[model samples]
Target: MRLTSGPAHSLVQLDTIPLGDWRALCDRALEPNGYYLPDWEAAVNASARGRTDTSALCVWNDGPPARLIGLMPVTSLRRAYKVPLPALVSGHPYGTLCTPLVDRDLAEPAVTQLLQAARQAGARALLLRDVALEGAVMQAISSALAREGLKPRVLQSYSRACLDATGDGDDMLRDALGPKKLKELRRQRHRLAEHGPVSFDIARTPRQVALALEAFLELEASGWKGRRGTALIQHEGDAAFIRRAAPALAANSQCEVVTLRSGDTAVASGVVLRHQSRAFFFKLGVDERYAKYSPGVQLTIALTRHLCADPAIASADSTAAPDHPMINPIWRGRLVIGDVLLPLRARDPLVELIHAALAARRGALDVARRGVHILRGLRTR
Candidate 1:
C-alpha cells in the first residue's frame, strides 16, 4: 500500500480525506466483510451530517485489481499548547465493536499501512479500541508507529461474551448455571408457568416490533427502574436514535420480547436482540407486581430455549453488567477485547501538569464509588 500525508482541513490528516472518499471506502471495505452491519451505516449517516468528526479510509491489497482489505476511523484532536499535537484514529462515539472489514487474509497489512499513513500525515499519536478482528492489527500498527520514533502503546484488557450454538437449550443452560444454579433456574421457570401461560416472542416485522417495543417501555417503567426514572425510552436522544435506526436495526432482525402473560395482561417482559447469528439479551423489565415469580430469571430461561430452537443462532451474548448475578452464572465462556478510553494526553507541559494533578484527584472519586447500587434485587431469592 502506498502512503500519503498532509493535514486535510480544520480536522487534520486522513480525516481530511473528503467525505465522499471516506464513505466510498467504508462501503466497499465493509459491505461484504465478516462484521458488516447497519450500525456502521448509521455511523456514516451521522458523520455526513456533522454530528461526528471521524475520518477513515480503505486499505487495498497491492494488486492489479486493488481490493479493499481494511478500513479505519480517524479522529483529530487539537493540542492544548504544551504537548506535541497528536491525532487519534479510533472507533470513537461512532463505534463499539469494530473489526476491520477487509478480506481476513489482508488484516495485517491493512493495519500496518493505515498507521504508517497517519504518521506520514504528521499525527504525533493514534489509538485503536473495541477491536474485534485481529490482534495483529493492533500490534503491527503500533510497531510501525514506533519505528517512526513516536511512542505507541497497545492496551489489551477487556472482556466480551460470545455464544457458541452447538447443543440443546438444556445444555446451554446447564453450561451457564452448572448444577446448583440450573436447579434454581428450573424452579423459577416452573413457578412462573404455574402462575399462568408465559410467552416469549421475538418480533421481526415492523408492526410487531413497534408493539413489542411499546410493551418494553411499560415493563421498564413498572419496576424500581421506573421509580428511579430509568425507562427504555428515557432520554430524547435515546428515543430519537432508536426511532431513526429502527428500520435499519430491523432490516436483518427485530426485537425479542420474553413476556409472562396471564390471560391478556403481560406480567413480565425482557427485550432481546437477534442480529445475524448472534442473539443478545439486551434489556429486561418485569412488573413489580409479578416480582414474586422471578420473572427476569424465568424469561432468560425461555429465551435460552428459543435460542436452541433457532438453528441460525449460536451463543448468547449477554450485554449484562459485568457483575450481574443472573447473567454471569449463565454465561461461562468469555472473549476479551479492547475498550477505547479517551484521556487528555496533549497539553502545555507545566500548565498541563497542574491540570493532570487536578484531574487525578477527580479520578479518585470514580474509584471510590465501587458500590454504586443502581440495580436492586428484583430477582427472586
Candidate 2:
C-alpha cells in the first residue's frame, strides 16, 4: 500500500488508500481514540449511500511500525476554496470530543504533514465545528493546528448538559433529577411498574447488538418514525452499521449501551460512548406504543438514576437537538454544546446569496408563527 505522509517532516500528497488493509489498520489504531474503527468507514459509506462527493482522508507515518496521527473526514467539492473537508465536522455525530485519534508523541509533525496533504488536496480552510474549548487533548490539537495557521473558533452560543452516572442508582438519580422532576418521575415509576415490572439490560457484542437492533427496528417500525422514513433500520446499511459499530465501540470500558425494557420487550434504548467521565449518547430509539405510559421518558429517568449511581461516569450526555426537551433535563451540568457549522468556501456568490435568502425565508416563517400565536391570543382575550 502507498503511504500518505512520512518521516523527516516530509509531506506527501494525501490520496485515500482503499479499505483493503483496514483490518490491520484498525487492529493497531483502535483504542479509546484514533480513527480506525469499522464505523468510520461505515459512516463515510453511509453518507456515500446518498452523495458521491464524500471522501475519507487517512494520513499516517511510513515505517516498520507505522502509526496514524490523524484522519480528517473531508469531501471533495468544486464549490469552496477547492479543498475537501469534513461533512459533520467539529467532531461528527456529537459528543465524541474525539479526533481521528493521533499519537500524542508524533501529533505535531504528523499533523503538520497532514495539513500539507489537506492543502495539496485543495482544501482552503479546516473547519472543526460544534467542539469543546477546554479539554486537554482538544487544547493540544488546537495549539498544534493553530501553528499551521488554521483558524479554530470557540462559540459560546450553545452548550450541553451531561449527567454523571458513577455513584449508584439513588445517587445518580439525585444528581440527574430536580425536586419537581424527582417527584413526577417517582409517580411515573409507580405507574409503569404497576402494569408490569420495568427493567434495564446492557448489550455488549455484535450478536447481542444485532438482536437489540432488530427489536429496536421492530419497535421503531411500529412508531411514527417508520412512517416518516426516519427509523435507523429503514436503511439496511444503517442498521447493519450500527449493529457492527455498537459492539466494536462498546469494547472500550467507557463504551456501553443501556436498555430499558418492559417485561420482555425493550421500550427504550440508548447507546453511550463513555470517554473520560462523559457518557456521550450516541444513538437512541424508542417505542411509542407505550406513549401513554411514556416508556421513553421513564427509561431516561431510570438510566439517569442508574448513571447517577456511578461516580466513574461523570456525565450522561445528550448530544441531540439543542432544543430537545427530553435530554435538557436529565443532566445538571453543561459539559459541551453544538451548532451546525456551514462551510462558506464551497459556494459561489450566487449560491451564498441564495442561502442568505433562505435564512430570510426561515425568518419570515418564524414571524408568521408568531403572528398566528398573536391571533390566537387576541381571540382568547
Candidate 3:
C-alpha cells in the first residue's frame, strides 16, 4: 500500500510510511521512543503476528518537501482491546512505551491535527497505551484536547523502573542497592567466577549484534519462558522480528546486545535500543543453570555502568513491568506510564461507553490472571 497523502493527516499502512519523513519526525520529536523508531516499527509490522494490520496516523507539515510532524501506529479498538467502539488504539510496538512521535516545534498543532485525523477515520476516541503520562507529548495532547472542550482520561497508570544516567554509575548503584545487598551480589559474582573469569561483553556492530542475539534467544529459550512457550524464538514471526530489527538498528548504532559470561559460556544476555539520548533496555534472557549466580542481575549491573558512562545518554528506560523484582531495586528512578483515552469530540456519549468497556475488560483479565496464578501455585504445592 502506498502512503496516502492528505492536506494535514493521513492513515497510512505501517509498512508504507515514508522512511525519510518518519526519520525526520523522530529527530525532532518532543520525546524519544526507541521502539517507535522506523526501523524497529517496520520490522515489527512486517514480521510480528497481529501487527501486519497496523496503520500509521500521520500529521504532516505539507511543505514542498513534506515533513512528518506527528506519527503513531494504531489499530482499531475492536482489534486491540476488543471494545465495540468507533475508536483507535496505539499498536503494541514489540515493547512498552508507545508515546507518539510529534515534532516539538509543531507539537500543539500536530496534536490537534492528529485528533482531527482520528475523527476523520470515524473514531470517537483515541486510546494511547503505555505512554509517558507526564511527558511533553502527552502535555501537548492534553492542551489540544482542552482547547476543544475535551480532556484525556488516564485509563491505567503505573511507575516503572528507569535509570538517571547523569551521575556516577557506581555511586548510583551503591545508593540504590545499599552496601549489604551489593556485597551479596559481589559474593555471587565471585562464586560465578569459580567457573571462569566472569566478564561483561557488548556487541555493537551488525555482525556482533546478530551473533549475540542468537545467543540471547537460546538463553531465553532455555529458561522458564521457554518452558511456557513464550520465548521469542519459540515463534517464527517474533524470532524473525528481533532477528531483522536488531541488525538493522545496530547498523545505525541504535541497538546493542550485552552478554554476561563465565569464561566462554554465556550466562545472560539482553538487547537494548537507543533513540536520541535515551536508551531502552528491551528484554533479558538468562541461563537457568546459572540461576544461583544471578547472571541476569549481574549483566544488568554491567549494563547500568555501561550506559552511565556513555556521554550521549541522559537516561535509560528499563521497559520492564511495574515493580519488576530484577530491575526495580537496581534502577531506582521511576517513569510514570499509562493508557490515556483522548475524546475526539466534546460531549460524545460513545467516549464514556468506550471507557467503561475498557475498564471492565481490564478488570476481568486481571481476575483471570490471578486465578491462573492460584491454580499454578496449588499445583506446585
Per-prediction TM-score to the true structure, in the order listed: 0.68, 0.70, 0.97
lDDT of 2 by residue, 1-381 (tens): 122333422222222444433434443331233222445444534442332233445556775566555554444332222322222222243234334444456656555554565554444444444445454445555666566544444422356666555556665555556677778777776776776778888666655665665676677666777888877678776566556656666554534567777677787877665544556666677877666676777767767766666676655557665556777766555755422223224433543443344346557778999999999899999
Q: Which runs of model 2 end up more than 4 angstroms from their true locations? A: 1-36, 40-48, 51-54, 61-64, 77-98, 145-150, 153-157, 166-169, 248-256, 274-277, 308-314, 338-381
Residue 329 lDDT, candidate 1, scale 0-100: 59
Give all candidates' CA lDDT scores: 0.53, 0.53, 0.92
Per-residue lDDT tens digits for candidate 3, residues 17-115, read: 789888888889999999999999999999887777689799988687768899989998888866678888998989998999999998998998988
Candidate of highest lDDT:
3
Candidate 1, position 370, lDDT = 44
- Per-model root-mean-square deviation over C-alphas: 6.9, 6.4, 1.7
Count the clashes in each prediction.
6, 25, 0
Task: After superposing candidate 3 on the true structure, give the runs of residues whose Cα lies further than 4 Å from its correct spot.
Answer: 1-5
Q: Which lDDT value does model 2 have at 324?
A: 62
